[model samples]
Target chain A: MKYAFYPGCSLEVNAAAYDLSVKAVAKTLGLELVEVDDWNCCGATEYFSQDELTACAVIARNLALVDPACGQITAPCAACFLNLKKVDRLMSEHPDLDQKINQALAAGGLKYRPGSVQVRHLLEVIYKDVGEEGVKARVKRPLTGLRVAAYYGCQVVRPFKDFDDPEQPTTMDEILKWLGAEVVDYPVKTHCCSGHMTQISEPEAFEMIRRLLYCAQQREADVIACACPMCQLNMDAYQGRVNGFFNTNFNLPILYFTQLLGVAFGLQPRELGFGKELVAAEPVIAAKVGAA
Target chain B: MSVTVKSKRFVDEVIEETPGGHRLRDCIQCGTCGGSCPSGAEMDYTPRKMIALVNAGRREEALSANTMWSCVSCYSCTSRCPHNIPVTDIMYTLKRMAIREGRVKDNDGPALARAFTHYVDKYGRSFEMGLATRYHLLNRPFAAMKMGGMGMAMFLRGRMAFTPSKIRNIGQLQAIINKARELGGAS
Candidate 1:
C-alpha cells in the first residue's frame, strides 16, 4: 500500500534516524511512501499552544497538497501524526475555522478541505495493514530473545484520543509481538518526554528524563523503542544531561520504532538509522540481520 | 536532614477516595516507583510512603503535609508504577482536595495553580513560562526572587513567547470551560 508521508521538524535535525529508518523500511516492505513534495513543519505540539488558527494554517498547507484519494497520510513521528490529526480533526469539527485556515493557505496557492486525509502513525500502518501474519512472512530472522519497552510518549495518544486507547495504548506491542520480541509492560511508556520543554525547563525536564531512565533501568528493558521523533531525540540525546544532573551512570539505548522494525525486517543494521542516535544503541543492539 | 513518614489518615482517604481507588491497591512495593521519583528524596513522603499511609489510613496527616505541594506533576510515579496507578493524577486530585480542605498553605502553589486554571479556562491549554512568572510575581508581591530571575532570563533569551495563544473564539472557550466547571462543580 502506498501513502503520502509527512516528516515533521525533528526528522530534519534532531531525529534523523526516524526519517531514515522509516524511508528504508517503507521501501523494503513495498509500502510506497511519497513524501508530500516540499512539505513544511506540521507545527507539531508547539504551535497549538501558540495559536490554534496559525497552527492549523501551517498543517493545512501541508495537507492541502496531499492527494486525498490515496486515503492515508502516514507519519513516522508520533508528534507529526498528532499535529496532522489535530488540523484534520479541528477542520472537520469547526468549518468556519477550517475555512479561515484554508483561506490563509490559499495565499500560498494551497487548498485544503477538512478530513481530506487520514493521518496514521507509521507503527499503525505497519501493524494494521502489514499485520502480524504479513510481518511473520517477511521475518527472515526473528529477534527471538530481545526485550523491548515500547515508549509511545504523550502526543501519540493523549488529548486527541486518536488511534489507540489514550491511557493504555498497545500499537507498539502488537507490532513488537510480530517481530518475535518479548515486550515489557511498563506504565510509564506513555509519559511525556518533556520534548522541547527540555530547553525551557531543564530542572523539571531533567527530573522527568531521569525518572523515565530510572524506570527503564528497573524494568531491565534492553532498549527503549519509540515512535515519536521528540521522544527518540530526547530519550537518546538528553540522557547525558540527565546523568550529569543527578551524578549517575546509565547506558540506556533509545530506538526509533522503525529502527527496531528495520532490524526485524532483515535489513542491514547500518541502513537502519542506528548511528544517528545520541544515546548509542550499538553496545546493546546486536545489529546483525540474522543475529538477534 | 531527614523526615519521618506521616500519619495514614489522609493517606488512606486519598487511596480510597480517587475515582480508581484500586490503583493504590496494586503497589508491589518494588520501590522502583519511589526510586524513579525525581522529587522523592526531597519530599517527606515518597509516593510509596504516601501509598502506604493511605493503605494504612493515617491519610489526614498525609493530606496535611507540605509534601503534597512539591509534586511537579511530571507523571513520573504514575508512569513508572508497576501497578499502573495514576500516582500523579492522585497527586492532582489530592492537591484539589487539599486546597478544598485547607491542607496546604503556600504562596507559590495556590498562585501557580490559579495561573494553570486561568490557562485552562482561557485557552484550553498551558503556558509554562507565562504561568511560572505570573505565579512568582503574585506569590512575592514585589519580591518574587525565584520568578524574576527566571522570567527575566527567559524573556531576554526570547524563549518565553508571551502573546497569549487565544482560543479561536473566547466565547466558545468560556462556554466549554463553564461546562467543565459545571461538570466538575468548580465555582
Candidate 2:
C-alpha cells in the first residue's frame, strides 16, 4: 500500500523516533510513503484559539498541497491528523466557511475541494490496511514476554469516530497482540495527556501525566506505547517531575507504537529511534525481547 | 444618550464562529462534558456550566473565566456530550473571544499559544527549542532554570533542534495567512 506522508513538525524534532520508526516499519510492511512537497505546519492546537479562520486556512494549505495522484495523505501526529480531518470535514459540511477558506487559499495560487484528499492516521493505515495476517507474516522477532500499554491519548479516536470506538479503542491493543506482546487493558488509555497544558499549567498537566503513569505502573506494563508525539513527550519528559511532585517512585519507558513494531520486524533499535526517549527503552526491551 | 444595540446574541456569535458549533443550542444541560473533562476541576467553570452561562447571556462572566484557557483540547467533552454540542469547539471559540476581548488574565495558556504560533508564523514550522526558550524566559524564568536539565538531556539525545526549519514557499504561506487574517477580520 502507498500513502502520502504528512510527518508534521513534531516528527522533525522531538518525535524523530516516531518518524524513523514509521519509515522503517512502513518499509518492512511494504508500504510506500510519498511526502507532500513544501508542506507547512498544521498550526496544531494553538492556531485555532488565536484565529479560527486563519487556523483553518493554514491547515487547508497542507491539504491543498497533497499531490492529486495520491488521493490519501497520512499524518502520524495526532494533532496534525485531527486538524487535517477536521478542516476537511468542516469545509464539506459548511459551504460558507469553505468559500472563505478557498478565498484565503487562492491568495497562494491554490484551491482545494473539501473531499478531494482522504486524511488518515498512520495507526489506521497499519492496522486496517496491513491487517493482522500481513503483520504476523513479517514478524521475525515476536515480543513474546513484553507487556505494552497501548496509550491512545485522545485525538485519534475522539470528536471523530471514524476508525475505532471513541471510548474503548482496541486497535493498538490488537496490533501489539499480533506482534506477540501482552496488551494491558489500562483504564486511562484513552485519557488526555495534558497536551500543551504542561507548558501552560504544570500542576494540572503533571496530575494528568501522573495518573497515566500510575495506572500503567499499577497494571505492571513493561512499556507504554503511544501514537501521538505530544503524549509521549508529556509522559516521558515530565515523568521525573511527576514523581517529584507526587512523592512516587515510578519509572516507565514511553515509546512510539511504530518503534516496537519495527523491533518485532527485526529492525535495529537505533534505526527505529529507540534511544531518543528520556526514559530508556533499551534495558527494558533487552530484558524482555533479548537485546533488541 | 447613545445606546449600544447588540447585533447578535453572545451564544449565537459563538455558535456562528465555531465549526460545527450550531449544535451549541442543542445542549441538554447533562453535565456530560464536565464529567468527561480530565481537567474539569481546574476549570473555573465546568464546560456544562459555561454553556449554561452562555445560554443565560452572561457573556462577561463566561469570557473572563479561566475555563477555556484551562481546556487541553482533548475533545473528550465534545465526543461525550449527549447532544453532541461540540463542547470543545465552543471552548475554542470562547478562547478566541476571550483573547480578542482582552479578558484573559493571570493565565499562561494565551502566552503559550502566542509563543507557539509565533514560530509557525515566522518559520512555517514550529521550533521546539525556540518556543520553550522564548516562552519560559519571558513568562517563567524560574521554571526555565528548573527545566534546564531536561532541555540539556533533549539536546544530548538529538531530539531538540537549535535551528528552525522553513518551508520552501514561505512567502506563499504568508500570503495565504495574511489574506486569511484580512478576510476573517481577525486582528
Model 1: lDDT of residue B93: 59
Worst 10 residues of 2 chain A by lDDT: A283-292
Best by lDDT: 2
lDDT of 2 by residue, A133-249 (tens): 999999999999999999999999988899998989999999999999999879899999999988888899999999999999999999999999999999998888888888998
* lDDT of candidate 1 over A1-292, digit per residue (tens): 8899877545654466677788888887888998776565554443333234554665666687788767779888766776688678867866766666666665555677787688888877888888877777777667777888888877677545546776688989878878888888878887767665554345766777777788888888888898876676576666776787799787888988888878878787677766666566766667422453
Clashing residue pairs found in predicted model 2: none
* Each model's fraction of native contacts: 0.01, 0.86
| DockQ for each numbered candidate | 0.04, 0.88
What are the TM-scores, per candidate, against the unseen true structure?
Answer: 0.62, 0.98
Question: What are the per-residue Cα lDDT tens digits for candidate 1 across B57-142?
Answer: 66476667655556544455665577778776566556666676666754245555565556544553445555556654555545
